[model samples]
Target: MFFWKIKKNPFDYLQKSFFFSCKPDVPSVNPFKTSKLISSYFKLGKIREAQKLFDEMTDKNVVSWSVVIHGYAINGFHSKSVELFSQMRILGFAPNSYTVVGVLVCARGLPDLVLGKSVHGVTVKSGFESNSVVGTALLGMYAECGNIFDSCKLFEGMKNPSIVSCNAMLAGYIDNELFEEGVLLFNRLRMSGFIPGESTMLTVVQGSVALESRIVAQSIHGLVVKLGLDSDMSVNNSILDLYSCCKDLDAAKKVFDMMECKDVISWTTMMGLLVNLEYAVDALNLFLKMKASKVNHDAVVIMNLVLACTVLGDLRRGRQVHSQAVICGIEYDLPLANSLITMYAKRGELQSSKTIFNQMTQKSLVSWTAIISGCLQNGHPREAMKLFMEVWVSENYSLDSALIVSALTASGVVAAFELCQQLHCYSLKAGFSHYRSVQNSVISAYANSGCMDFAQSVFEEMGCLQDLVSWNAIINGYGMNSQGEAALALYHKMRKSRGDIDRFTYSCILGACSHSGLITDGLMIFNEMVEENEVMPCQEHYGCIVDLLARAGCLSEASGFVDDCFEVMGPNALRALLSGCVLHGNVELAEVVAKKLFEQDPEESGHVVLLSNVYASVGRFQNAETLRTRMDKQRLMKNPGISSLGESSYDFG
Candidate 1:
């Protein structure tokens, strides 16, 4: 016992074992055991282990080969699976229906169609093409590969296809965005007396949603209910989504309430519908109810909640939602984070918005545009321009029309003329100048930057591509630049064209009349807008009319107009009259308009200043000083006027 025994090698011990000892004499166990282990490994997602075991097998049967091939295909290793299928065939192992299906699965994801074609050839050679299951798989593979032509041929060749096969083809059409084809096929299936399954009906409903046909959607809903498929959560959700897309909020809510077991998707879809319909308050209240019901809030729900808070401008609630977003661990989600930035910026909390933007690890073009637009809106145009430059220098971001528009706006605000021209050049080079929105933004930027000539040139170049916005922008530019004649001419031309004149169009022309003292033209156009164009005059139109009359030395007529429309006129109308009074030295009317303005908004120091200036212009210095004293007593401070040069310097006092 004390003697040192010789160390036995594990290899020798394995050789003496029952399996290896009978090697070459008995049937080999390695192939069978190894194949089973490979299948188990494949099931457990140990793909490398399965592959290694499969490679070591000396005799692979069709079953073992099919396992590896199917496993690789389904697991998204499509190329590796296709290679194994070829190896199996090279080994002279005849293919079965299962093998053919596995190969077809591999073919579904092949970027190169040649391999799929080869697999198809093998299926035909193996005489497994007649198998319904195999045929369906082939049809699906062709569809998934975007070979609709081949898929259609394969589908037509199938004699008396099963419902599953028909659904596969139908789904292919829908997935390819061939909604009309899908609808035609659905009708044919119905005519053939084929009762569609949940999948088939879902596809049809999707087609209906894409078509945005309310009648078709309603018919599909009725069919779903008749088929007793409305109870299915997926079908119900699809119905709800269809109604939401069509803006049928009542029908969507009805479908939502009918759902027996509402999932998170159901709740989120309903909340999104409310938000989309501009019922922000209702959306927030529903979200609170959802929280009270112990339903979990996902990123989508949080984003909706943030949007609601943004719309309401409820900073307290917005902050609460931000905290909840952090707790949910989705605060860093790009879209949700971008939404948070928008919420804070809209609330006038630029510091908080910047903090959120800085904390983002990954920023999208939309994210950049959101913060830049926020900066511009919050009166930080210089900062916004700087951010735009940073975005431009970064190669990771591509400039979209939205970002371009935002940057152009910032450039206009800062009076960065050179920068504006550079952006215009870049837009042309990037091929974004052709985009109607970008073109409009460029026009507005040039006009706001005191380049009406460039703005007009862009407008004239738009030709037939010019939309209503283009006309409005150029007309407004002319009005702002005191080119009232040009503005009126453009308005007349727009009227002659196919462009439908809107309220904004009328407002711009009226503004031109006010600036150029075209009282008769203003009154005539106002009548045309109402009677001919059927455009209802809004508060702005009323203000324009009052200004037009006041500027034309018809102070009495302006006052009478104001009295006539006093019920509908806001402070802006009175303020417009006050401005005209200041211009024409009508102190008496100025006093009346200022008093009305004060009653409307007590804190508006501009109205006080304007009236004081009118008094000073009329040599009533004592009255002007008295007004200044009253302003001091009330602690009202006039907002500083901002003027900018071509560079970054701005004068503010």
Candidate 2:
């Protein structure tokens, strides 16, 4: 019967139709009959049914024992399999090569390596140690049990360690986060002329990603194609993961688009790439596309969708995804709820975020941090501080690094310098004052709270020096205080330092250049960034560049630069360009940019006002009136002009 037709490969699953050909009394037959039927049931993942028949067997042989052992081992019941192995031994049924492999797999979950060593002894006594299948199994068991030393020892002792054994060791090193060791092992495997298969490629990619070695990742990708392993799903997914983790969204997309067969994991990975890249709209569209393709969306995809909606500030989409989360029974899952609240808060919907926060049955530190951070983002610093204090009083919660950072950020908002100092002392006691992110936040908090002296002191005490973000925080702090020359000096020192210059650093430096009207210096830094720094200019950088050029009265140069730097045109760039044209009274250029800005974001009232200001500055009263009339007709209110609000008091407020 067609139902009885089984694929010759042992790895293949039994056909569903084969149930029709199964005899009703098959379980009551002889030992061979029971073993075959049990093996079939085991292969189909009917573990309980297989276990019932095995329990009924009056005279079980080694084959029947091996079958049950393998079923338990493969199904992740490692302890039960090991216990059954002892039972088989008591019954005087010696384990064969396959049974030895099964027993080794079962020994993985054992805490002590003694059981695994005993299994190794059994394999040797059974003369199955020489079998490559059993050898790989033993190697994998040692690796999984964190006995890397023993695993490598086993591989070295083998007359010929197969590619499977090599891949297992490589994967073990990666899982242990010994990236350098994994890379070296992979190199040694290549030198030994044992061709790396897809699994090896995946292991190497995992190592590269963990190390954040983009060059190594790219090389591994090349090796994948060179070795013809790119078609392997595991290899492709690893490549995708590496690119996403590296923040190389373009590279990730290239790998994603190159895949001929995209599984749900692949789709989820692509969605993750979009989220990490901050292409939330595109990510949501891709997720909808995945659903349209009939691919099952897992929890990861759902989380990505929630993130995308949050970014787009599309409360409607967020609510739709929330409904889906309810259907999936994860809506109130603490992490998911925390994420939803964060998204809503970022979109300025503090009410919805607060409601969700209040509804959580169980709250983690993440939940508290999310709601507190949301309050900070939604301009409720007092509310944020209240929540932070509540979290502090609740002894059930632990203050993680993120929680402290958010509290410090809120402290900066309220200019609660004394509270910030207390938090700083707490951070020191917690030993997180030395943590990079925590230290960076401390510096930013001190700088923003007008505690420049404290900020400088913290900056000087950082043992590992400063990262790009630290430098940015200091430079931006200096810029905020109108200390342009000081900011410029810091920028020069940063450029001279051997630190990486991210977009934030470039953006800060440009702000300094704009403030100081350092046209020559700004152009120099911009050129250096594009040429030497190789930090791709995003909208922030482009805005800074345009502002610097415009402040120097080079409106035409700034306009031309904007046209060229049109890859990721954002509101800031348009504002800078329009402001520059208005400052110079370049009516033609202002008209062009304002029209484009209005077209792109008509709801933003600043563009029309900039055009009106340009017209008025150029003595084009008629044009100014015309623009005003247009604004009135469109019900667009001009943004308030820069306030010369006097600091009557030298207080922090």
Q: Pick by TM-score: which candidate is best?
A: 1
lDDT of 2: 0.83
Q: Deviation in angstroms for 187 in model 1?
A: 1.6
Clash counts for the predictions, in order: 0, 0
Per-residue lDDT of candidate 2, residues 181-222 (tens digit) = 999988887887878776677778878887877788788899
CA error at residue 382 for candidate 2, angstroms: 5.6
Each prediction's TM-score versus the true structure: 0.81, 0.62
Stretches off by above 4 angstroms in model 1 are 1-37, 40-62, 79-107, 114-135, 288-293, 398-401, 411-436, 449-467, 496-501, 527-536, 549-568, 574-653
Tens digits of per-residue lDDT for model 1, 366-462 = 8899999999879888889889999899899879989999998888776677888999999999999679988998998998888998998998898
Worst 10 contiguous positions by lDDT, candidate 2: 641-650
Worst 10 residues of 1 by lDDT: 1-10
Local distance difference test scores for all models? 0.87, 0.83
Residue 374's lDDT in candidate 1: 92
